[model samples]
Target: MNRAERPPATLTELLSRHDCDQALLAALRERRLPELHFYQSGPSVRAWTELCSSSAYRGYARSFALVDAHAQTIASALPDRPIEVVSLGAGDGAKDLRLLRALASTGRRPRYTAIDASYPLLAGACAAAIESGYPARGIRADLLRDAHCREAGRMLDRQRARLCLLLGGNIGAWDPGDTLRLLRRLTEDQDYLLIDAHQFSERDTLPQYDNPTNRRFALAPLRALGLDDSAGDVHFRLGTSATVPGLALVEKCFEFVETSTVSVGGARFAFRRGDSIRMSSSGKFQGHAFALFLESAGFRIRHQFGGQAGGQVLLLAQRRGAGG
Candidate 1:
């Protein structure tokens, strides 16, 4: 039997076993304590909503186009099977929805599964899927961990032929080498994977960390903790790093340089300037390097789409067969 036919664990079970919230909180605190407080305060939902809905963020649309093309390719490969399109970090499912809608137009009804760690985002995606009359379900799991991958693999095991989607620079944000290995383990011979590969050009400048919009977004949770931006020296800085041989990771760090009163979950604290608060990193990849990484992970590149807005590449890879 294919792995997609196995019974999988529930989202609740995965979350409890992983203890993601605690891990996230600890990671944030150790790296940048203020950011942890801000995240737990919960204004990121609105920020993410705004980010996805804004005209400035057209990356989703481009991603949607690539997904559509990928769906067509997968459909051609497994013409008679129920397509299982599993999206990791699905966000609002806006891009995936576009692909599903396109597939429906081609008379191919896909079983849509969205995997995400954010409950709010998953809920929103489910609602949207319901409204669209699509056969869709959501699994709330952190794609960054192995157990989550195992659970996802079990879920996929229940389906026919599978088509996996990982977009929105999600792979780039995490460790690509590790992510690719995990992905390889989850994918079997019957699956086709579609992952977004972002190209970094010298002309692409980093966004300002403390822009008015960004500051407002970051301040929402802080205010809930009775800490205003004015109550602290909130400094935001932009920097870039490399996660792999050819991938560039660029991100912004929002720090509380100084604060009079800082309280989180009822605990109170005070801090001086020069203290780092919170940081969020976004990733960009070199196309050639991304292709090489995928090949190394045992995927045979079937097709590649390039020349989109913000310089993106879509890789359609199939698992390698035995012996050959």
Candidate 2:
């Protein structure tokens, strides 16, 4: 309650649980192995850098605006109480910093906490927050686990009111139904959520991924693992399933065709043509279905906004009261 001095030490420490390390390790291994191999060769950093710096990467800005508006709403809802802002997947804290700066103009000093899985990004956020004169702290935790949610709940329990943000279409990047339930479990009473939802669209989604710029972004991390575009064939595809009405699911899968043998950590590894790696992140609900998902999440929508891409939705919702 007295302002955390630093972010949680490790994913396990933050969650306050220990059983899932093996499962988590496996997931991370699957996700990072290619990147790690590419990093060994030193060309992947460029892709990762470009991916984070491009205009498309700044999508969180829209969410930040919605959050600022939501903050104003919360200020009106709890006229005399202090508000605490917690951001899940708070990448680099740039967007949140904008809101904090605006809050400062209003003469309201809010306590801020940013939780992220990336240490480098968390460090950047910490530095930015400090420079901006915010009493901010960062927590490194994986939100997919229950223990982390419980810890987050404990942190929010102390605030008079809390605003939790899950930005960058992070919800769509995973299973929305389960993710929403996990989000609800982490939220304490009196907390609000400002989340970005992808509007479902029938247009060609592959071009976005296939774009040279976007492809560079995707492969940068892979290149870091010593895998080049020529090293493997990258494939993109969509998953058609009806989880909710009006929502279309498209999944981008990257298959790296290894052309030669590589070594990592003093060990040798080999790859063949048929061997493929899959990196599937979902893009969902580009339009109307976006609204329905929020309603199903037990949130009473207060307002919504249209994004520049025409397929993204930003929603400001309040947790439904008991019996609502």
TM-score for all models, in order of appearance: 0.79, 0.78
What's each prediction's clash count?
8, 18
For each candidate, the alpha-carbon lDDT, in order, equals 0.63, 0.59
- Measured by TM-score, the strongest candidate is 1
Query: Candidate 2: where are CA atoms >4 Å away?
Result: 1-25, 28-49, 52-80, 259-271, 307-309
lDDT of 2 by residue, 1-324 (tens): 223544332222362223233333354346433221221123443464565556654444445556555555544443245667688877667767766665555666666788865556666676677666677777766676677777766765364567677776777666666578668876654467777765554564545455666666566544544565687656667665567666555555555455555443344445666665555455666546676777777887766766434345677667786777
Question: In model 2, what lDDT does residue 155 have?
Answer: 63
Worst 10 residues of 1 by lDDT: 33-42
For candidate 2, give the lDDT of residue 294: 75
